[model samples]
Target: MAKLGIPAAPPRGRRIQETITQLRQRILAGEWPVGSRIPTEPQLVEALGVGRNTVREAVRALAHAGVLECRQGSGTYVISTDELAPVVARRLTDDRMAEVIEVRRAFEVEAARLAARRRTPADLAALDDALAAREAAWRGGRVAEFVEADAALHTAVVAAAHNGMLAELYASIGAAMRRTVTQAMGGALTPDRHVDHARLVAAIRAGDPDLAAREAAAFLEPDPGA
Candidate 1:
């Protein structure tokens, strides 16, 4: 320690990180609407009272989080908030299981439609891999492992849609619901149920979203008392 010393260096990176977090929170809070242009780098520097590098770093961080899109010529803009919800709330809420089913219903319905239209040979292969993993889990009495594959199969449907926002939303919900679904199914996803998955793949191969959607919905329905 010096008897007389200069002030400490600013915590540039931490400040920038906090600024970015606040910006994302405001966007999710709807203070910044979807597709709206955020402040320019210079403007953010002024508004945040930070250095230019700080603002730029914050913007880059937000861009990487999928909340902001930065174009070369155009300024940054808010993308979507589907993935920005509180993960803790998702995990702790009792009603979330029902909410998951509802969201799954709407999302998978459209996902099936789009997947059937868009699924390629590679997508079919991914689906097959997930199903095979799930079948092996059932046979081995590994309920947790099977539930993960079930989640993956649903995620594969959204991924097959080739829509970034939908895929992100499905992934978030899948993470939140894995344990609940495993408990609900209770090690009872039988060979016949696995056959339903095979049929779903067939529907996608045939480019029939309606049938695929129906099969997906059937699998998600809550078991009695489950």
Candidate 2:
């Protein structure tokens, strides 16, 4: 029996997994936002109290999962927040925009219906802020800003549903949804394709689930211009 000595080290596989979780947590916590390079190898080793190899393995794992991107000369950068984003994007190719819209209809319509039933005052307040921001972004005519704002408002609706799984699933496929919206708008958003979500919001505010679901589904209908 050994005595007066340090405990045995954890298994190498478990250590590597723990390191990966720690790194992912940092990214999710916004310690290093997307496009920002992460701490260097030595810095991470010191910070995580792990060896150089362990830090390297963790970074490599995240890179494989599309959450981190390591350039040839520059440091590694945070690319995506959700681990499933890249996977979803890859599965939903560009040519499948119709399928993408169908997927959106499934999530958004249900989320809207449930939001009408379950949303709280705070959720309604957040939705109002997001909707206003989305409209302002559209009027500003900055395609990228508008895309993000629109996505934010839809995400707010999903959040209001108060179903953790639905919210998480929406977030998982969020990048793909934004990509389709961007493609549909092409280079710019013409007045002809303007989408007014005021009715959708009003239905939710009034606790009209059927109206909210109808409003959500209506927006996803075939619009040659939209």
Candidate 3:
């Protein structure tokens, strides 16, 4: 078993690990930006000098890690550049309902405060439109429409903050946030709910950060003992 000046081949597992590391390095280095489609499987195989199986496994690992997302009838795309994206994705999948609601509350309250300080006329107009849609859905007894409008209003508030990172984070958990909104609404269309929404919008429009934060917290507060 002796061949002078010859190196031993790396183990299969080690080779896969190396491949994964290389791919991750490329992705994190901005060779692939978030939301951009990655190289096709064959291209990756050729470029990485790895077997198709190895390339597929590396891609799957990155996808499960939330750095990439595979769309049906389309190629894989980078979903996030953050190394923490996988952790956040896992937590969102595993966190309890109350925990999810708490996270959303924190983000929304801060977003409201920032929106009050940063919103422009266009932002205010969008918020007003969202509010109007919500009220219309409520009065018309359209439960699904009401839930959608409620979520849109909150999204508008966050967009008004003009913080790209915050907006991206909020968007990442959008589905969970929508579910939380629907649950919080509980199929009710009360006048008090409309009043609370109006007050929150007014606070933001007036550029009162403290009042806006308070109003947002109160608006999103969960029912006691729910």
Candidate 4:
């Protein structure tokens, strides 16, 4: 990570907490856009006039919150600007998969309903493109590609809802959901899942909220027999 040099004064408060707040403000203010690397530890320490440990603690805090991501042998990069990202990131863990699934269902079900009512032609087009990519990947026996497209489709559906907060929440758990999807794909790739996706998209296109919600729920429902 390369530091742009501290552009502001140290925030007035507890050293570490203030440092964290200031860093977060910088990110939110677009000083560092998403995917942009943050300043290195030494640079941060120098800029903030804080100890090395203070800088480390602030970085760790932000990273855990999902605002910053540290890549081994590389540097930290901004993953998101959502203020809720850190909160959601902290709660999303392996042990909480069930809870995560429930939350995802809540968002997706409502998203489907809203999308049926609110989706524009552009939204439908994006959905179609994503579905086509997913189908092609499945046909090609490309698990990774299928997973990526599947994720993109779900994101498109949520985005079609046109709710900023809902979209942010969905984006917050994106990393976890992608990992889960990849792992599931390691098992058998069932044809019905793709069929379900097509059904959901069709319902949305038809502008049937009830049908769209039902299709979305059915797609998300875990197979009891599995």
Q: Give the top-scoring candidate (lDDT).
A: 2
Task: List lDDT for all candidates, in order.
Answer: 0.70, 0.83, 0.77, 0.79
Which one wins on TM-score? 2
Error of 1 at 153 (Å): 1.4
Candidate 4 CA-lDDT value = 0.79
Against the hidden reference, what TM-scores do the models get?
0.58, 0.68, 0.59, 0.65
**Candidate 2 local accuracy as lDDT?**
0.83
Candidate 2 local Cα displacement, residue 15, angstroms = 10
User: Which residue pairs in model 2 clash with each other?
Assistant: none
Model 3: residue 160 alpha-carbon error in angstroms: 0.7
Query: What tens digits encode model 4's per-residue C-alpha lDDT throughout 1-226?
Result: 3358745644434788988988999987877755446889999888878889888998998887777877554478676787677678677887776666777789899999999999999999999998998888788876667776787789889878988667667767766676677666665576654444898999999999999999989856865753
- What tens digits encode model 2's per-residue C-alpha lDDT throughout 106-146? 99999999999999999899899989999998999988888
- For candidate 4, give the lDDT of residue 18: 86
* Stretches > 4 Å off in candidate 4: 1-65, 68-79, 188-195, 222-226
lDDT of 2 at 45: 93
Alpha-carbon RMSD, each predicted model: 10.9, 7.0, 8.3, 7.4
Better of 1 and 4 by TM-score: 4
